[model samples]
Target: MFAGKRILLIIGGGIAAYKALDLIRRLTERGAAVTPVLTRAGAEFVTPLSVAALAGEKVFTELFDLTAEAEMGHIELSRSADLVVVAPATADLMAKMATGQADDLASTLLMATDKRVLIAPAMNVRMWQHPACRRNAATLAADGILQVGPNEGGMACGEYGPGRLAEPLEIVDAIAAALGNGPLRGRRIVVTSGPTHEPIDPVRYIANRSSGAQGAAIGAALAALGAEVIFVTGPAEVPPPAGVEVVAVDTAAEMRAAVHEALPADAAIFAAAVADWRMKTARAEKIKKTPDGLPDLALEENPDILAEVAAGPDRPGLVVGFAAETENVVENATAKRARKGCDWILANDVSPATGIMGGRDNAVTLITDEGAEAWERMGKDAVARRLAERVARALGPVGAA
Candidate 1:
């Protein structure tokens, strides 16, 4: 993978700068030719000599250097690469990118370039949590900029939370995904995950134990296989994977709308365990329990996202749904696939007896239009990979588009 691909690497100033050196080696090992660009601050953390030595080429830094510009103008260098990646993206640079401030050479090239940009953010936990950073991140995501890490853990500032750069291997994988150009290269996929909450009152709501792990894994696996994935998930236990679109939702109503908006994709996987019913009329204010018996509340049905998408004119080439049943797993799931107008359904027994619900391992039965195939219990990661491979094969291969 990534053989002969040209990658423009922008190393930002941060303690994680050394990780970029390893990232360079990983990319080159995969046969990717890398052009390392160091920011003014980036040079403070890692020297150009070391970077150039490892890259086997001159490291770019200055915008006004006479000879460097003659051979590779900032204008030319900016747009030459297939993909541009920034590891250890600091708060200042993120701000510059957000506000279109091209004052420095790195910022200038970034602004001038039309290449697809991927940034692995690294900052203090407080800075990452600031409203300003949130707004900037949202703006970048909306503009189609990709993000990887700043994963949750102990930080450099002796604090703990989400602000560490993703590991080098993960970054390399993200770069490979960008340049893969596989069969699903340009194809879009929508995946729904986790269970939704239905509010009963201001202080309480009805929910489930779903972790959203399976659906999120499916989205990542699909992205790795070369699809542009739109992952809409309810509150989940696991972090959604990097290098794909993510939409977070809390309620069944929100999940329904998101799915509709992300439709017309080449494929869809409805893995979310959306609530079947919601409070007919939830109290605006929290209802205080009284000595008197509590009032009985009416309930209403929530939209069936799977059925809606499966029946729509924008239905994908493959529409796969999940059936997390307590009993009659295959019999019921097969019926669901047909009723929902979908091509395939992955059903599993999630009864109290299965021990798979809310667990890392899963035992799924793949139900298709033709028949059902039972699979042994395995980690959700393995299941996702196998399922994604099946999707690729059924639709014909990574280069089959």
Candidate 2:
């Protein structure tokens, strides 16, 4: 997908800097031309020779290299690439970037670059959580810089939190999504994912078996198609997709508010498995086991998000909903489409016997006003891609901005 693309890869100082070598290979294997830039501190973790060897290009290391400057000035070099990627972006490096420092070659290129900049931050757990680091990250994000992952895990510093670099394949996918120019370019879409937790008490809640894999896949696919996606997700087992805006919510009420706030979108996809009911009067403390029999908890229906959004004043041009049924899938989903007033309904059999719930593969029937279109069993990502294509086709060509 990245054929003929040019990538300016900057390696920053960190233990995760070693992953940049594999990232270079991944990018090159996909037909991208990689120009490697190794920071002074980054060289301590991974040698410039290794980076140059993997990228099949000379590594730029010095800011004052007479030959390099004579050949291609910093400004020219920065503006020449299609995209700039900073792997293992250290805390110091990120702070420098946030402050617009240009003391070194890597920071200089990042500051001078005209193309989009994507960073994979890597730092100690405490460093990642520090107020200063968080502020810098927020500043960078506000400046429109793209970020992939500092996924949560045990760090090399014997601490565990969100400071690990994203895997090579994940970075490759983010790169592809950033470079893609698909049919959905210039469009904005909203996707809700995961199972909403309805609190029964301070310690317990009601949720479904949804892993949020399908919804995350759909968001990623739409982003790969060049759409700006707003991903409103609950407590999902799967992480949210890169290259999208993520709004994290816990309960069905919170999800509903988040969805409504992400309005004026080109399309909206309600893929969350919201709880049907919540305790009308949840106790402030955890319900204790008493001599009394089971507590009579009064249950009330949660907000019907799909119906409310479909019937809202600022409804998107296209609104899609999901129906995960154990029986009469098609019939029930068809009825759901009419009742919810959505543009399309994706019906799937999620019976435990089918293993579709919390599984990677899916067999879905796309129910539209036209008719029911049953798709064969496929990976969730493939289904997401196909659905994204359908959405693009339905929205037609990009109109005047």
Candidate 3:
């Protein structure tokens, strides 16, 4: 998809700079001509020779090169590329870009570039969440600059949070989307998948039959269509798809918090089968069989994630929820759509005989305010694609006024 595309890649200093080499390979493998720019700090992590070798392009590191400047020059070099990308965009680089500082070659190129710029921020957790960094990020967004991710995970510093750089494939997908290569290129969608486990104890939990295949498929489909997908998922049989931001959680409350954190999205699809209740107070130790009958367990309700998101002030333009019903599928789903205040509900029969609960195929009825549209049984991937197409149609053109 990136054939004949020219990407000026700026590698900033950080432990994550090593990932830039792999990123270059990923882009080049897709037929993109990558021009490597190495920052002074960036050079400390990965040698310019290695970067240039992987990119198959001359590494640009100096602002004042009499020979090179006399030829292509900084201005021409910066403006020649179709797009400018900053990978492992360290806090220093981000601050420079945000404030328009051009003391060095990397910052100069960013300042001089006329093309759209995308950044994959990488920093210490504290630095990423600092007020200054947050302000700078907002400024960059407001300036029409694009961003892929500072995905949450463990970092090299033995800390965990939202500071790790996105995976190379994820960055590639974001680059494609930024280049307007897909229909949903400019949109951001949130997807909740898997069955939330409500713990009765540390070792035992209550969950449903959801495998998370449908939600994974949906996230993959949305990303393939160029949408930025924030995948909030629980422990499930299926792993999340590539090219999406994955937020893994265990309980309903964690999932709810993750979903809210991923909000202000263009659309939200709730496919997770969250447990309705959890033990009000779980035992610190295991309950063993004794002369005394059985241990008494108190339960409390879990937050209704779909209903809350649908009725909340930060509701997305399109809200979709799933209803796994064993009887009156359409009728129950239609009522669920109304009761949950969601825009649409996909109802499916998970009866043991149907084998749809943990099976490969699904027969679903889509319930909207207009009416119910029953779809024939099909593979989960096919259903996801169809739903994604409908979503694209309903949302209209990207960035539409």
Winning model by TM-score: 1
lDDT of 2 by residue, 91-145 (tens): 9999999999999999999999989998888899899889899889888878888
> Which of 2 and 3 is the better model by TM-score?
2
**TM-score of each candidate structure, all chains considered together:** 0.69, 0.67, 0.59
How high is the lDDT of residue 140 in model 3?
A: 86
Tens digit of per-residue lDDT, candidate 1, span 1-401: 77778888999998889899999998888888889999988899999999998888789898888986786688887888889898879998899999999987788888989999988899888998898998888788777787765655567679876687777875775666666754456678899988898999987887877988888778877776678899999988866765578899999999988988988788899888888889999989988878888778789998888888888888888999998898888899988888888899999999988888887679999998679999998767668868977887777654445
Q: Model 1, poorest ten-residue lDDT window?
A: 176-185
Instruction: Sort all candidates by lDDT, best to worst.
Output: 3, 2, 1
- lDDT against the true structure, per candidate, is 0.83, 0.88, 0.88
| Tens digits of lDDT, candidate 3, 1-401 | 79999999999999999999999999999999999999999999999999999999999999998898887578887999999999989999999999999998899999999999989899999998898998888788778777766665678999976688877876786688778886688789999999999878767788887899889878877876688899999998875765678899999999999999998999999999899889998777777779989778888999999999999999999999999999988888888899999999999999899999977788998988889999998777668878988998888777688
Query: Which stretches of model 3 miss by more than 4 angstroms?
Result: 1-178
By the lDDT metric, which is better: model 1 or model 2?
Answer: 2
| Lowest lDDT block of 10, candidate 3 | 145-154
Q: Tell me, what's the RMSD of every candidate?
A: 5.7, 6.5, 10.7
Error of 1 at 116 (Å): 2.3
